[model samples]
Target chain A: MERNNDVWVFIEQHNGKASDVSFELLSKGRKLAETLSGSLKSVVIGHNIESLAKETFRFGAVEAYTIDDQSLANYRTMPYSRIVNQLVDAHKPGIFLFGATIVGRDLAPRAASHSKSGLTADCTDLQISDVKYLRVDYKNLLLQIRPAFGGNIIATIISPDVQTQMATVREGVMRLEPLEKPGIGKITKIPYLPEAFDSIVEIIEQHRQENKVNLKSAPIIVAGGYGVGTKENFRFVEELAHAIGGEVAGSRAAVDAGFVTPDRQVGQTGVTVRPKLYIAVGISGAIQHRAGMQESNKIIAINSDADAPIFGVAHYGVVGDASQILPLFINVFKQKLK
Target chain B: MAINSIVMVKQVPDTANISGQVMKEDGTVNRALLPAIFNHEDRVALELALQVQDTYSGKVTVITMGPPRASDVLRECLYMGADEAYLISDRKFAGADTLATSYVLSEAIRKIGRYDIIFSGRQAIDGDTAQVGPQTAEKLHIPQVTYTEEVLHIQDGKIRIKRKIEGGYEIVESGMPVLVTVLKDAVSPRPYKARRVMTYKNAKTLMELEKLVEGNSLLYIDQLKDEYLSKNLYIRTFTMDDLMLEAERCGVAGSPTKVHKVESVVLGGGQREMFHATKAGIGELIDKLMVDHIFG
Candidate 1:
């Protein structure tokens, strides 16, 4: 066995709570580690994050290496990156994975840069494969698969020469496996060293947006496209969403046309969603738009155009104007639910 | 100090019209089949740089690394109000993943010298890795703000930027020499000025002039380059030698990530059940969705 054969997942936490993606990474990391016949470890770095490290056992990690410090509480890229870089130098793990969250995107590149390693961003799939490049045979190389060319082509990338294969997977791409029996994992506390130049950028104020709708985790999503017309017309989308107890989302066109907020946008440039039910209203079903929600279990598309592209991935389609169709849906749900 | 901005742009094959033969076996794109255009997000990045330059009275230099045809985007950048444009093209630079590409770009930026801010698109439509800007910043040992939507203010060597997060936007202030990756919707790219287009249409890179002189022996390379330089129509060109980049660290050789496979996904409509826009049709959809446990 190689000396550094451990798979490590960076556990990201927000507001002192571990992110679901961290658990998802543990579930995924366990499989990769098992394939390599190595132990699955997780690195949790933050203030008062020992509890979160203990929680890693439930997901599947065998060892939780922690660097808890007050300065690490809020994510400042420099300090967080320095800790991860030092951790890599100490442990020399073969594979490192991070959640493709804002913090991950910011910190992974910095760490990869510091380590002089390669990092793949926003990976959708990870697997173990034997890859040969030139004269060297890379055994059990981590295959990182992601969509390229605007989600038209899935490109599998592998870091053949780098010691640490780093990748960041988007939220909800991997499933979180909660075992019936909690596994026992060792928690190793790493002392934090106060480093100079910890942070260059200072956060004056940080707050969440008012009424932030988490469309990614929403079970049911009612999305409107540009065909919905005006910003006021989006009220029909909201009414229908409220009627069915679902979140209101929009296509890129709808967001760009001022009919919806940027956060409500659902597409390649926006957010990827895999809800249980996705009802696309007035969407033309462009490939960029479908890339996000095609994974939904059930898709129902309503559009005035009978041959709109949205019907391609949808299980059910209605040939009607969303303005008229959405109101009808709202009325029926209002009467049926009551 | 007035902002001296450099905008990194890429000429990406138009992804909207892709068909089956989109990717080569090695995972670099099959660029011949599709038409190329200035990447939409990079155009916005250039527009943001131009806006900052306009406000602060500085210079906006655009740089791109691609094939000879990539000079097209450099010309467009000039027509769109860039004070200068550089095309870093060489055969050894092909098949470069984000890592190698960022290395070469960082080297070029270092050679380009004075610059206060660097602007780049969040990601290219071709690779969509979104790693180059951040990676370049790391290589240059500077700070970077990705998914930036607005530049709130720049003063006293500190720049305040509003960047997009998952659910909201965050305003961050960083010192000068920071890299910003702009979003496509950050701002509407201004149209090329008709007069600037005519004036810069004759702009030619060194390689381009070499080709021109080779084709027409009537004109000498030295005199033609001198005339173009006098007219401010000669786009700056850099090769690997010009940047003093190591041959092994500039292209495919420097790229650590190797392509394993390329799969093209085509969304199909075989399972779609069409409805007739009637009252019964709406009711049927709800019932079917409920039965499938998608709704209850």
Candidate 2:
């Protein structure tokens, strides 16, 4: 398997709209393409997705390889994977990337396995590097960096033995680049025969989850952790958030303790939030937790442990019990409003 | 109709006690120094398997690849209601990454005979690759549903599953002989029954029995293993030879991805101002926060 000489991104779309992650990958893939002195391409597979293929070019793709058909209107495991694997086999790329969404997670593995390639999932970062290890010179290896061992440590991985290095980066991990210009690249429609629509998954029903918590764009968040102690004590966190007109979130520990619902968890396994102001109550900032909220505009940590890791990322730190300090903070806000 | 189901489990070092010494310079963990326990997600996966058994008539078989001491998690699985457990242990299987481990597990799964469904945790806490379950399903050439939050139903030879995506979940239906990698919050595992624990406490794998025989010259390994098997206390064990796996594909040799480097990350904000528990300190903090427009 020789080098394919290009970086490719899978432009994920549903109902004729492209996912934000696909655009982010295109932006990141553009950087890899520059480093490798190669072209950047986008792989689009869906019915009536020509608009998305054109949109990829605006995001920096030099080409879009698309497979359009009525069977691709709704995502099914068998057909989507077969088509992606077919493209990879036909036009081998130096690098391939997918969003770590449900669809991508379901499709990428089967495609990679079909090609006998290695794939790193849920990656946080990607880079190109040249290094020497074990007497092997890894020239321009894709640095697939991810949090491992339950988010206590970060590990960098590379597929030295295989071609077409693949990775599925989690959504929102990388910032999306603005469009350089629109429709600068070409769209090459790959042929898809009707027989390729064979699948075992029956589409019983598909709809968006209504009333989903919009944690990504929350203006402010009041989050609690293990130090909050009990389910009843979490109300202190909610009261402060309510008084400040913000949403409530919790650390993995708090969520595991049943103090809050899984939807309200603020960590790597949960949501990645960058609220305007993030108030972390009694949260000892594990890297997993920090990875989710470290990008907030202003951070204030309230914890009794003076050396807690959360303080390391806080714009302001309060060295006292949250239960005692939250009441005081709420009262002060009440007075200020009056 | 009854179906045969297998659950893949792992024993991981308790990373909550992770320290500088726990991680070797080569990026591999020093498992001897740290306390080992059942991987949390794998435990939840077993619970899901048991629940499937309770709903549909079936027997749950739990298998794991680790050192001989890993039999602890196996017996615990029995105490929690696994029908049978296997210890897939060998020195050659040490330091196995996801690829090697999945290879060995898939081979043993083939030897274990028929199974309608296979369950595993989405990712082990130690490696965090989330690769083995999917990789195994691929090797076995079966469909897999990962990040599974719940098993909706199983009827007419098809199973419905609700799986977690980025922001929400989607319900999917898969035909028979599918694999599912479960999430930690999928289900709360039932507590070990006191009676089952008392009955299975002396359960031992063949390796454990060999060790016991080594210390006592009067006892023979075969005799003891047979005795335990008759008493329903012997755990099925498999080595590399038992699974007929190539030596090259059993451990580190089969792993393609290498850890380039390991760095201990310590968070730093450059400065942290500490406030006393007094009212004056609280008032000053409020003023600073308000000035920064963090609070209005």
Candidate 3:
């Protein structure tokens, strides 16, 4: 077995709590590590983040490497990336994963560039496999699969020549499955060396908005599209969502058409969603939209056009005007739940 | 110091607004059906650069790396009030991953020196990698603030920027020469000035001039390039040798990652159960969903 076989997931934390995407990566990393017959490890670098490292065990990480310092409280690109670069240089990890968040996007590319490593952004799937290219065999390569070209094509990418393969997966793409019994992983504390240059870009202020919608955690979503037609017409989607006790969402077209806000947009450009039930109303089911919601457990698409693409992934298809059908949907749901 | 800004832009396929003819029935994209335009976010970045030019005493120079046809975007940049444009094009530079592309860009930026700030879109729509800007910053050993929504102020060689975070936003301050990747909604880009458009419409890259001089014994490529440069109608075009880039480190060879496979995503049809538009059918579907605990 090669020494550089361990898979490392970077644990991201917010307000001292670990991000769910980090846990999701840990779960996904377990399968890749098992495929490679190697241990799963996680790295956490933040102030008072030892608890996050401890939390990694529940997600199947075997080792948790940590670097803690007061200066590392906020995610400054320079310091965070340098610390990651230090870890990469010292450990020579075979595969490193980061959540494709604001911090992750800022850090991963810099670290990957500095290490002269390959990094794929916004990967939806990852697997470990043997590969051959130019008549040369490479063992246990990380296959990073992502929807590129505006989600029209799914490309499987590999960094077979690089030492450490890196990928940044967005939140909710992978399933979060915690172990039945949490096994305590060995926690290794790494020293954080302070440098003056790391403070070149200083964060002057940060403001959080409370009303940020999290469609990722939504169990049921009723999404409208351009066919919902107008702001007046989009209430059909909202009424149905309220009746079903589900969140409201829309296609990129609907958002552009002012039927819904951009935060609730579901597509390649927007956030991916995997709900228990995804009811798409008046949506044509563009591939970009499908890239985000096709993974839902059950999808119901309603469109006036019977041939709408959204029906391709839906379990139930209704050919009808959203205005006509959504009232009926809301009425049935209200009666059932009442 | 007045900020001299270099904004990285690209001519990208209009992937977001793709139509039926653009996507063939076989699930592969029909190249001829795609129309290349200045990437939306990159144009916003250029608008920010032009705003920097407006407020401060500096010129905004735009750069892109693509085919000779990519010179089309450079012309658009000129029309939109860019003081200068550069096209880093070479046949060998094809199939470059983000890292390799950034390496060549960093080298080009070094050649076109004397810039206090660099700007680029957070991510291009085609690849959607968002890696090149930060990667170029790393290669150039510069600080970077990405996902920038607004540039609040620039004074005393320090720039303040408001950038989008996960839940909300944060403001950060950085010194000169920091790379800022602009978000799409950062600013509304201004339309092309009719006067500038008419003036710069004749602007051609060295490759384009070479094509113009093709099969013409009367006109020489060097002479045409010289005339165009003197008249400010030439977009500075560079080959690998022009920037002293190593052959192996400029393109596919330098890329650590490779495309192992490309599967055209074909969402299969014919599995779904169809229902009539009637209220009865709607109730029946809802009943099924509740019974399956999908919406219970």
Candidate 4:
């Protein structure tokens, strides 16, 4: 084991509540810590966030660093960056992982800059390489896999020179570690100085829209793609989602068409979801779209073309018009519920 | 008086495409095998910045951080109506992520001297980190507006911009010397002007013309660099030495992030059993979901 041995995962939180991605990172971080002969640690930053830290221990973190300050409540780039920066410098960790959420997207880069570390964003896969001591061979490297080329290909990247390897994994890509035992993690409170925090940019107000759906945590997701045809056809997907008591998701194509918001998008450019049941309607299943939802427990694809790429990874493939098939499925489910 | 804007652009490898053999197992992307071109969203961002330059009666300078091959985007920038183009290319800047990248770019921006605005795409498709703009802004200690979809109006040293939010959008107002990260919908970058392409075709980075001049000759590399600098044509290539950046604080040595593992997940849908419409069956279905921890 190295002298400064700790595996730290940034437990991303919003509005004093922890994001599910934090648990996912903890799941993966636990394995990485074991491989490197280190202990798992988590950094939680927010106001009144001790409860979130308690949850971190249930998911494999042995020690949790909590920076609970009023200024740290809502995520502003500078303050959050400063806090994470302070922690990394104080406790040198072998690896720092974050969920590539909106807050993570804003904070990770700045933290990496402050720490002078390399960061790979939106990675789908992460692994440590076992390399022999110096002799010029392929054995010594940490391979980081991410979708590239607009999601057409998966690139395995390695950092052979850096000590602490950092990456931002997409939300829902990894399953959350079960909370079998009560949390046995110790919490350390970092001193905060409100006077030191000064942000040139202020998040004036966060407007919560009426139709806001937490797609990241949705259990049942019915997603649409380009094959959903025109913008009007997307309604069928929404109907299906409503029938199944789930939220509506869209491929990058549907989001680009303005049919749905980027938050509801399911793909490399959008949110990664691991719902209990994912019904991909009229989606041809580009690797980019699949990168986001391929982790779902069950994938049911409805496309007119049987040879559509979506069917390749789908657990159940129905070759028919989504406009027609969705309504049928919705009616059947409704009748069954009745 | 209007403000001058300089946008730093780069031509990254189309990293989205990754076959096991894309790197030839040699760690370098096979250019012939893989396609190389200007970054798509960066081009659009350049266009948005150029539009501001045209409206405000100022010059737009395009800068890129890459090898001599990156000169292509520089030329393309010139054709797109940029007043000047610079390429910051050096061996030390290779394999840089957003952190190291911002360091090199900030140095080049400093060398270029004065500018009111810095424009960059929200993120490059290749590395979707979206960190460079904010990081550069942080290093420069300037205000930054990210995910900007439209530049509403600029007047009296105050810049009004519309930035994309989660559900909708928000209008933000900032003073001059602000770094704006542009979204794809901001403005469509214009096509290259044919005349400028013809005139600036001879523009060359020191490394580009090094082959003809040889390792040593009447034209010293430093002197040529000076000539370019004097002509305002120098790309302001900076090494770790120029930035006074400690070698340990740059490149892979400086980066502490690592990948733990990689696995491809294949989602499979579960069994679907048609349920009877009776009251007992309806109650049972709801109970099953609750028991499974999927719903309650």
Candidate 5:
């Protein structure tokens, strides 16, 4: 089968549910498909994930290609990559997009490599350009735009020779299209046989702690930095997070200080988050750090230094020690909730 | 059985100190003014891989893709205890993002033939994309443990690793030939050994040797390569032909994505007003925030 016109998005999911970043990518894919006059297709790889295809269509995919093999039940790189590669090879798309999530990060590159295609990662922006044919001049052209250099510059890239363009976009930078009405999409299931390849690695088990928020999908986040003083001060930030019904995050500094594990870190070195409400406590906001969380819908910064760089990107600024202000804010929230 | 590990490293432009004149108007970074350094986290990754090799009594190979200047990092890798180093450099490999990069690295790995493990930093400091390691593992069809904080144990070809999850951590176990993307805190890269540094400092790639021969007719390029290879000082250089990579799939023609534009955004600070901790004032502040869409 020759597949040439559709745009494919890797729909990332966990625990039998869709990741928000998948929705974000689908939204972006919808716009791109519209620009290219093509259909938006999503590829989902998981075990017993047939029900999730409808949600993908609602998010903007016209069809969802699901690989529900038992080998793909877990988030291991090998099976996921093989499945995605098989789909891409079988159904050649003009463009492929993935959310730069942990799974997407692990899967997209491998698929691109296997396909021998180009991929741009962590793209904050994406757009398709049109070619104006001039009869007198006899000319045609194409254009692509994306942000570059720590978000310092925007670069327009064009490929005059290839049939497909692939990129992994960070989540929350794009908006998902609203589900207007229920739409039915076809799901084609593919078998995954682990024995097909000489399996070098096997996933033994998976675990998650109770009461921990998945920062990638959290709606509200309260993050602390080195300026939070010590490990104890991080608890103050946590108190505010709990009062706000949000998750606790930290900067690379906080992680380096042993205030939190590297997983909760929000920065270029950590996780990229786009929560609805991001409260940065004592974060000075280096560009590397802001690159991860600057996409949050609303950002409030609390720090002792008025000139802290975080205030530049913050929607609101509180000039006070986070140690004192966090507890006060938590108490205020508690009183208001009552 | 010892773990045979391969580490993917990159020599990136020191973008932290990039100045106005350091970048061309066309958006390409000027390599001259910007000192090329071993990517910080990749060094940390190399350290972790070396520690594993030391603990398991295996061999560690370091690989990088860049211009001839990339050999600097490869030699550093050898000095840091890498058993062998390969420099995958070609003019055709320029302008590659993480996606293209992982493809080239995977191809090189296939050429190197055998490996039980792979290690890379979470992301390169220059791009900060954190996509290459996982992408390479995906290409190689290997299971990957990303954001690894520590390797708990390796028993019976099953490697147990403590990886950082969203809020906490998960102990994941994968079998042999796993790709482990490490964090900075995983391990501090050991200092360069004086003997290894002195031994590999004379290491040269084919291009470098050609330039040396041009400067001195008495120095034969072939002889230099042989001597360096015998002394384990030569960076194994591979071309597209060497790796059996298709020309169309190896460079710009194989790359479909194009860079669109480059601009720097100078985010300015916002205005602020202080309020006393009065109950009424705090309520008013909350109301103002709600009005401004900051809170509801």
Candidate 6:
């Protein structure tokens, strides 16, 4: 079963439920399978994943491969990578996908190196197309599109010579559509034999702090970027959000510059927010930042540079200093709200 | 417990501040036109390694694989209190994807010999793959901990680490010979020391010394290398011959993935409307937003 035109997605699950990105990949994998005239399959590896396997059918997966074991309940580097590598070796898939989260980054590369497959990390887009390399024509090469050079450029990667082409996509980039009528759900169970090496690293303890900043559900979001300049200047962006009853968010640059926390970042690496109203202040709307908030109902951009990229996507763009424009806008907004 | 640790480092271009003339006409970034600097996350990783050495009686050795010019970052590593440094350079190792990069690095690490803990930045800025540390671990047949935020405890070849998960963090423990990829927020990296800088500024690799010898006949590369090595100023340099690497698996040939095409970013937005910066214009915009029921 090596090199089947099938598209496979690694269903990452914790506890008993699968993550959102896995379902999103399933939805997109179906489209890629159709483009190749093949089938979409999902691989769920975790304990008590029987229900999770059934859930993949609603996301258009024709088949689900399950490997459930108590020892494999939580994600351990050795066990997970070994089992996934064995599966990849056994089933020669043409394309494989994983969510570009912490788990995926840790596991995908091990599989890639073990299987000697071509794998691209943090891909934002995936497509199937024919290509020519070294004067040889290749059919149905998986085009892995991703941001590179610190998100300065987009690169399309291909593995014309490898049996399986794989890519890890960031969460929230793909659309998750549940089928009205679920697909033909079929689950194939694989046995897990615990190896001595599986217990090398132990999870001695864990703590979960639910992110207090839930920007996705916010109705209105006021976001800032590196252009906000400093932590003090960023207050203007927040003041406007406060005046308008909007949530506070920022770009990755803002997070890196210590203007905002990483949880409040509105970009590809962060949450994908489609708030009703998105006010972007002092942001250039790089493709990475824009990827997360582009779906907002209304996008208003305020920046000093009139030709800034944020203006391109903004429904209403104000060319001025955010420090000045934000105060005036907040004053007027408060007066109107009163 | 005395430990031997290795920190993988990289020199990346300042991708943010690069203005015009950085991108070539073909839509690819001209790295030569951009300013190259030590990657911040790797600096943090180096700092973590140094802290580990401070707590436990250990020496931290840093290594980076790049062109001859990459020695600059190695010198910076020495300035940051690294006990030793290694520069992996070879023309054949150019154009490596993460897979190939990890393969070559795994081989190079084996040559470097004997490390209890291998530390690296979670991912480099330019590639942002975050794959090398774990992939190299896999190649080395070792367990890995990625997205590590901090090292809670390290003693007697056992380490307790706090790593970031989806919405939370987990504390994991592993014995020696484990690979831990550090997050940027792990620790604030210390600044370079003036005394170390003064001493290591002339630190050069054998390749660099050869170039100096070529430019001036008075300088002999072997004598220069001997002098530096005697003074402990030689940054351990390795070529393809130094490591047991398959040429087919070292660089472009070893890379399974290829860049089909590169495109300049053009994130075009759906709508385009401009409002004046004037106070009256701001008021009009606020009124419009209120009518839309978003501002109010």
Q: Which residue segments of model 2 deviate by more than 4 Å?
A: A194-197, B16-30, B162-171, B185-187, B293-296
Arrange candidates by lDDT, descending: 3, 6, 1, 2, 5, 4
Interface DockQ per candidate: 0.46, 0.50, 0.72, 0.21, 0.41, 0.73
**Which pairs of residues clash in candidate 3, taking residues 3 or more apart in a chain or in different chains?**
none
**Candidate 6 lDDT over residue span A20-89, tens digit each:** 8899999999999999988899999999999999999999898999999987888888999888888888
Where does candidate 2 chain A have its weakest 10-residue lDDT segment? A194-203
Better by lDDT, candidate 6 or 1: 6
Worst 10 residues of 5 chain B by lDDT: B273-282
Candidate with more favorable, higher DockQ: 1 or 2: 2
List per-model TM-scores for chain B: 0.88, 0.88, 0.95, 0.79, 0.86, 0.92
Q: Better model by lDDT, 1 or 3?
A: 3
The 10 consecutive residues of candidate 1 chain A with the worst lDDT sum are: A202-211
Task: Choose the strongest candidate by lDDT.
Answer: 3
TM-score, chain B, model 6, is: 0.92
The DockQ of predicted model 3 stands at 0.72
User: lDDT for each of the candidates?
Assistant: 0.84, 0.84, 0.89, 0.73, 0.75, 0.87
- Model 6, CA-based lDDT: 0.87
Docking class of 1: acceptable
TM-score per candidate: 0.88, 0.91, 0.96, 0.76, 0.78, 0.96
True contacts kept of each: 0.62, 0.54, 0.86, 0.21, 0.52, 0.90
The TM-score, computed over Cα atoms with residue i paired to residue i, of candidate 5 is 0.78
Chain A TM-score vs. truth, each candidate: 0.87, 0.93, 0.92, 0.84, 0.75, 0.95
Model 3 CAPRI quality: medium
Listed per candidate, the RMSD to the true structure in angstroms reads 3.6, 2.9, 2.0, 6.6, 5.2, 2.0
Q: Which digits, one per residue and each the tens of the lDDT, describe model 2 over residues A13-97?
A: 8778888889989989988998999999999988999988988888789899989998788776677777787888988888999
Q: Between prediction 1 and prediction 6, which has the larger DockQ?
A: 6
